[model samples]
Target chain A: MESVGELGESGVLGRVLARMGEARAAVVGPGDDCAVLRVRGDAVVTTDTMIEGPDFRLAWHDGFELGWKLAATNLSDVAAMGAVPTALTLALAVPHDTPVALLERVAEGLDAACRVLAPGCGVIGGDLGRAPVVTAAVTAIGELEGRAPVLRSGARPGDVVAYAGELGLAGLGLSLLFSEAADADGTAHDRTIAELWARHPEVLAAQLAPAPPIPLGPIAARAGACAMMDVSDSLSIDADRLARASGVRVRLETERLEGAFGAQQGVRVPVDAMLTGGEDHGLLAVFPADVELPVGFAAIGSVHEGDGVRLDAAALEPRGWDPYTVRPPGS
Target chain B: MESVGELGESGVLGRVLARMGEARAAVVGPGDDCAVLRVRGDAVVTTDTMIEGPDFRLAWHDGFELGWKLAATNLSDVAAMGAVPTALTLALAVPHDTPVALLERVAEGLDAACRVLAPGCGVIGGDLGRAPVVTAAVTAIGELEGRAPVLRSGARPGDVVAYAGELGLAGLGLSLLFSEAADADGTAHDRTIAELWARHPEVLAAQLAPAPPIPLGPIAARAGACAMMDVSDSLSIDADRLARASGVRVRLETERLEGAFGAQQGVRVPVDAMLTGGEDHGLLAVFPADVELPVGFAAIGSVHEGDGVRLDAAALEPRGWDPYTVRPPGS
Candidate 1:
């Protein structure tokens, strides 16, 4: 296997770029100093980073899956803004000894995700450098298409809170990976990964390569969503943030959550997991009480004239992953 | 100093965001899923990454300088496309024990660069994560303001080649640091950085925090520049690339180069340094011979009906930094 150092930057870059598809809005694509994009309306931009230790483990994540997750995660943020994603710029750095094939696979995965999740959206520009570990930073751009952005602060007291895409399955998948595929000391390994995947393919796929409903963002906006945000951290944590931002309280009914997300692809997801599972990349939205929920969205709660988040009549603590404070086991 | 791990993600994010200034084009700033920008015309996007060990050493680079360089480099790329920079997104990852104050300084530096280099451009959104070393990836977006982007392949025969901003000073500074402020084994240290900075302030500043003539990009476009690119890797190498892309030959005159950039800011730069120096972040442009050069630009060469690059009829080999192949000493 040829390493990046052996093939050199240009060599690896050429191969990696060859795998990328053209973005519909890109007037000038890669190889130039910058990629020029045609914007129809207001532009929305978001960025996210995934590092080796805290974000993923090479032992469990394939390059394709890593790249897919990177695209999906940032695309979800764009979707949460009720915009159409147009382009992604990636900044990837890895150790000198990293295989060039890994980068090619990553590009393939990124292209695949864009085609499947957000058609016509693609990687437009990026940079490649050397690092101590695999590090990827993705910046996604979206077009609002003449509509007002669905800000988190727009939720009203009489709005119905709804959720779309995966909810707790991702968090459950993460738990399963740590418990079954990791050593006793918490170090991740692939020794049982095949067996684990064979037994629980849905959870593993949900965690490793999420396919968030990207198109539903515009649909929900058109359907009269009052406020929206990507449920990246967790339903409870992100809901609390939206509630505080909107000066309202979010009351999630247990029955609604279970009814909507209890059995995702044959995987039983408990209400607790739905509240606290991270990396779901789903959309949490609020709409007027009179408005109908979008086809892909299910009503899970309601907004009330109060502060913070609640589970029915009980106050729910906002607990989720904090990058600085949360040290992944064995990392 | 309080470490990031102690402050937690949101706590550190709040302090860091407090230091950022507002972007004029921003409709919605940080704290949301994405930053919304009211773009006037076509948007140009670019991304770049800097990682510890390979890109820079903490011993010589203060947090502020590192952040400033990160913004400057990416902004230069946006400028190269004849666009007015609008916003920046930074993805920063650092060790858990890293000081929170350092991150605050980084934000301050980013805000300061946007204000000084490209007013109205500021950090809009970003992500924070944990890594083994300090890693920063910055994506800059610029609005073309309805003008067609100046591309590298637009140069034609009889066009005059020009250069603007710092020429060889940045590369001279890098050489000076490696020779004076680094140990024999190539490990960088700050013990002698103060003395070196005092002796060669211009070069050090050029290398550490280049203020590339970003405004000149739009100026050149308005002045009828046929082709343009930022001189990031070296005049020789980038000139060759422009020539190849344009399907023409670039003939650089030594006397013309000496007359324009021999004594930039009182530093007598050798012709060789101007040819091979990297990280100048200057604009290299080609304009019709009949058009007047932009105020900050000086003609140094001319396009010919041939291929490759030349120096007064002598063939010049293109040479510059390759991140994967070039191992910084002591790193």
Candidate 2:
């Protein structure tokens, strides 16, 4: 296999660019100084970075899965804005010894994710450089299509709090990996990966390559969602954020969460997992009580006149991932 | 000084976001899923990455200069599209033990670059993560304001090729640093950086924080520029790309290059540096022979119905920096 060092920058770049399909809104795509996009309305831009060791383990994540997760995570942010994702710009830097095929797979994954999750959204323009580890940054751009952006601060009292897409399966998948596929020191290995996948395919898929309901973002906005956010760092943590942003209290009902997410894709997900598991990439939205919930969204909570988040009658502490403070299980 | 690990992610983010000012096109700024921008016309997007060892040396570059360079490089891409740069999204990942002040300085520099280089442009949205090295990716967005984008393929046989902003100085600065400030093993040290700056401030400034003629992009477009591109990888390399893209030959006059850029900002630059020096971040544009050159643009060459780039009568070989193939003088 040829490495990036052997193939050189331009050769690797050509292979990566070849895998990228054209975005519908891209007037001029990759190879230019900038990709020109035809904006239908307001433009929404978001950026996210994923680094090896801290963000993902090469032992556990295939290049394709890593790229897919990168695209999915950024695309979820655009969706949370109630916008139609238009394009993505990826900045990828890896060690010189890294395989050129890894980058090609990453590009294929990025292209595949865009095609499957948000059609018409594709890789536009980006730069490739050298880093000590696999460092990928994706900036997603979306169009509001003339509707007002659904902001986290837009929810009010009497608003119905809803959830869409997968909930806790991703977190469960991660837990299973750490427990079954890693050593006591938390060094990840692929010894049990195939077996883990075979036994927990749904959870593994949710964790490795999440397919959030991206189209539902604009749909929720058109259906009159008052506010929305991507649930990345657990439902409880994000709910607390939305509550604080909107200056209201969010009360999540236990029965509703269990009933709606108890058995997702044939996996029994506990209520605790739904509330505390991270990397779900699902949407949490608020709507007026008088309006009907969007097709994919399920009512799980309500906004009230107070502050912070509540599970049943108890105060829910916001806790999940904090990049600076948290380390992976071991190294 | 407090480290990022000590302060945690949110605390570090708060300090960084505090330094960002609002962009004129920003409908919503930081502290959201995405920053929303009011687009006036077609939107231009670009992304660039900078890694610690490969792109810069922390011992030599202050955090502010590093951040400023990051913003400047990406903004040049937007400007090359004949668009008014409006916002930047910065994805920054640093080691856990990095000083919080470094990040603060980085944000301040990003804000200052926008204020000084592009008045209405500002940092809008991005994420912070953890990495083994300091990795930053910036995505810049700009608006065309209804003007047709001046693409690299638009140059005609009779078009005049012009260069704007600093040329050759940045490459000279890099050479100076490698020769003087770095140890025998190419390990950078600040032992003589102050003295070097005192003697060669012009070259150092040009290399460290280039102030490319950003506004000249739209001005040149309005003044009838037929083709435009940001000169990032030396005059010869980028001009060859432009020539090939347009299916025309670009003949650069040695006398014109020396006359216009030989002594820029009180620095004596050689013709070789002007042709082969990289990271100038200047604009190279093509205009109709009959059209008047924009104020900051200097006519340096002309286009002909041929292929590749030429200097006077000889074909010029395209050579500059290739990230993968080239290493610093030593380790």
Candidate 3:
């Protein structure tokens, strides 16, 4: 399996959701870009906290980017609950030496992100504490409008598999970050791709501003998908998860996957990269054979009568993100 | 205004919520016992975090007591929301040196507290992180069957102000902590309030196991409370808040207050302590003239048309918890 942290943030999220224990009121838990909470009869709630060194750092990710990521992450939880986000509460623990404007800009990013991703959801309440580490926890509430929340455990066998939202982009962007390059500012620049990461400055933006295939989760559910999951981790690895949970076998057509990804990036991704790379935050669902999938998804696999996932007819290995675990060359 | 931090955790929460920007989905924001989040339909959501140094110290509060406090504080948020808490998610960050037995004992406390206060809620999901601080964040969700959820903004003039929990007990317990008193086992000895606190031991347990008057939020709301708030800080200080927000004057009947308080402690709290001590986490609400309050609440005073909190027809000076700006008496 890929190193959990290396598969990066979204990958870790996907893997964690797979291991989530069942809780009745959970309605919707981690995975699918956000965790939706069924508040009561009319609203949904969600909260996300970002740590300094583990989630982000001033050294690598700027404060504004951190702010945007924090809001996006929390709001995604509301979305996952099938609820329209309505408000956000922020609790901040910041070091004293940090500039005040930085905090303001962080709030600015939160406001801006709300404007873009959740228009009706505004920043409302929160706490401010002084600490050496800068930690921000955003709690969001949403209105479900009488819709059933989609959950990670709803997947089952005989369901047609489908996905929406881009996969591998954020992971590839992060991989590019380790490259050595420079820009006009005499600082190492970021690239959108690993090869260009050192040559340009967009790489950091992609890593910090991960655009989770947000809307697809509900859309897939609405389309009558039986078993569904988010592809925040590598495709093959997540497929294996679906297979295990649903008591079915997941098969992947490597050629079709290569064509789909190759056409987007103008280069052929290593099979393992498509199989083990993480941070996609895309939706992966299964529906009845008659259901029609929305655009942005290519049918690259299917689930059949079996237990767990397979690729081209074999018992596939577990290859998703695992922070405390080790990884192999391909993984 | 009082230095906000002087009120300790609960006081700080009250002050911050007082200034919480207005929003449509607040249903209940901060203060109270718990934050009721209107999630999907009629569900409520609340969250809280417990830190090692400020919230708990291993050298003082034991693992079970710490866990009980953590659960109590988080559950209090749900109660503040006026919701029947249904579940809880805990994200705990601890140092690698922490023993598994300590973790188990903490879980035991979690179980015990839930059995007492929140039978509907249990420790749900959790994350274990390696850190120097034993950090834990619990996001609790509840349900509000069909009540007009209560909030902090409804106080009206001519209302009777009331409270449903002890004041200054935890703060007094904390004071005993800094005093040069301890039994051989490091646990205070037992029995009388003074012995349990000063001479005996179990009194420290009250400070450790602060069972929030969680049931009062909903009860107060049902009692036609004009404006409801929690008394996390000193009575004088929090009363002033209700007064100011309601655009009214608050007059504390010190004699009656001392009478009721002395019956329990056998000690009349110093005027300074009564005005500045915090961390009671009790419910304070304003009731209409026609409403009769439930048991345990005394009509501390009345709210009249005016501005700011008043005491015996005089401007009450603010002095509560404020970590950064507070100076010890005679300092």
Candidate 4:
């Protein structure tokens, strides 16, 4: 029951550092003024912010899951750049009354994500602060390993648009959670919700802790990926971003998208979720037209000399999860 | 004035990108999944966070100044490692109702800091989100330039401790501000504080926008510094940190400390502030006894075989700004 205020900053830091083992890229790790890392060739850096209210509901998620999501969100960007994740730096601002045990769980989650998703990558540096709400700011650094970065601007007209990892499962999971909450009345209790959640573990995991295709980034780059990005927002919205950046248009076949969404049993899969559901953390990449598709990638669309994203000859609206417009579920 | 809610996330991001300009180190800047930077050799990475309530007060500091301080706090860490700053990544969480113009000012401040303090170093990437309070998390990347980083643990018993830049000035500035605020009544106005502030421009600048001795970090390393770190908290506190890391005791001379104090005519200088007041962003370094002190650095203490820090043959208490215990002035 002891909170972070009782445990103190140094105590919390000691727990975090203990969870994060030695990093291969780090010459010097935490406790130093700056972490010294070995950077081979170009270094790719990306940063992401997740707030308690807008990004997650603490009632539905624990510190461990939050930590994994934070790492997934940042590492997914590193993977999108066609680089190998080398190191990470985290800045956490939490309420003074937050449980130190919760923070330790968060550290465990971050460490587990790094170990499972991007092996050898570790947290090199971080900061802890007191705040009203829990906020995580993660920066992921990656090594290019002698390959040119697969930028979003490199998509040519004749490129083949492909994706690695689940597309709309996270969105479906979120929808399920929302529906479950809405159906709850005065009689609903934690026990019933737990039973309900137990029935749909896969969908909840996709929403709460996405396993992004981190390793496929380098593989796609080696296979001559023309352009690449992580599908953090809506598939349509992010695809439109790639199209605009590359000065071309992306056209997705409905049948192909349907094929990707095979055997949806309990949850009713919404088509809009597949197109606009964000937080999937999947890789959306464009490869050379003649290049062999990477092992994990499946062709979902194609690029042409036009603007914007289209589906079945119809222009798709670039709408996704806009944090400003939508309130966090249960908030 | 238009608020960030009206502008939306992408609209605000576009404005921020327009202000960032081109970065020398980044092959890809903002508007992408990741920013790719050309890393020469080894990379020095550090991260720091500043929250509105604890780290800073909006009533006392504006967005532009807050931006600069955020950069200074992170860049100073890079300087402690004896590296050349290359790029920075920022993650900002602000209230949705925050003024768009204020965010622009924040961007201006970030740009000005990079232009003035560390030329060629730029903000390569950043993330923005909605939160209850304004928070800035900054991660600075630096190149070691083929020199081994001066770690805090490398100090020897015979090492001479030196400091670059002002000591205890920022804390003094905070004290001045606090006193002025406390003295204000119905009769007291802005004019009275301005009059009080006119007497100590140096101290105010040191607190509001500290120009840390960043260049001195590399210079000290090249000059064979045994250990180095930025004086972020208090002189004694940071010195104690260096001592603990090096497993040695640091002894400071009273006369030498007085000499560093120079002439304090307008305001009475507190000895405790001089020893324990932090936020100075000064460089605390240890060098071989025979090595010539680098330009702009003044010898302050000597390292000896023992534990903890001492002044004039007595143990010095490691008291400084601990964010967990102290509230911002006038909060």
What is the DockQ score, from 0 to 1, of model 1?
Answer: 0.90
State the lDDT at A270 in candidate 1: 86
Lowest summed lDDT across 10 adjacent residues in model 2 chain B is found at B322-331
Q: For residues B273-317, what per-residue lDDT tens digits would candidate 3 score against the true structure?
A: 666666666666778867998776777777777777666667788
List DockQ for all candidates: 0.90, 0.89, 0.14, 0.89
True-vs-predicted CA distance for residue B267, candidate 4, Å: 7.5
Q: Provide the TM-score of chain B versus the true chain B for each model in turn.
A: 0.97, 0.97, 0.76, 0.91
Error of 2 at A144 (Å): 0.3
Question: Per-residue lDDT for A111 in model 3?
Answer: 67
lDDT tens readout by residue for model 4, B49-151: 8988778766556678788888887888998898989999988889989998887888888888888878888999988898999888999999999889889
lDDT of each: 0.91, 0.91, 0.56, 0.83
Q: Pick the candidate with the highest DockQ.
A: 1
Candidate 1 residue lDDT tens string, A75-174? 9999999999999998999999999999998899899999999999999997999989999999999999999999999998888999999998888888
**Interface Cα RMSD for candidate 4?**
0.6
- Cand 2, B chain, TM: 0.97
Q: What is the CA-based DockQ of model 2? A: 0.89
Regions of model 3 farther than 4 Å from truth: A1-48, A75-87, A140-144, A181-203, A265-268, A321-331, B1-46, B181-203, B265-268, B322-331
Q: Residue A186 in model 2: shift from native, Å? A: 1.4
Q: How much lDDT does candidate 1 score? A: 0.91
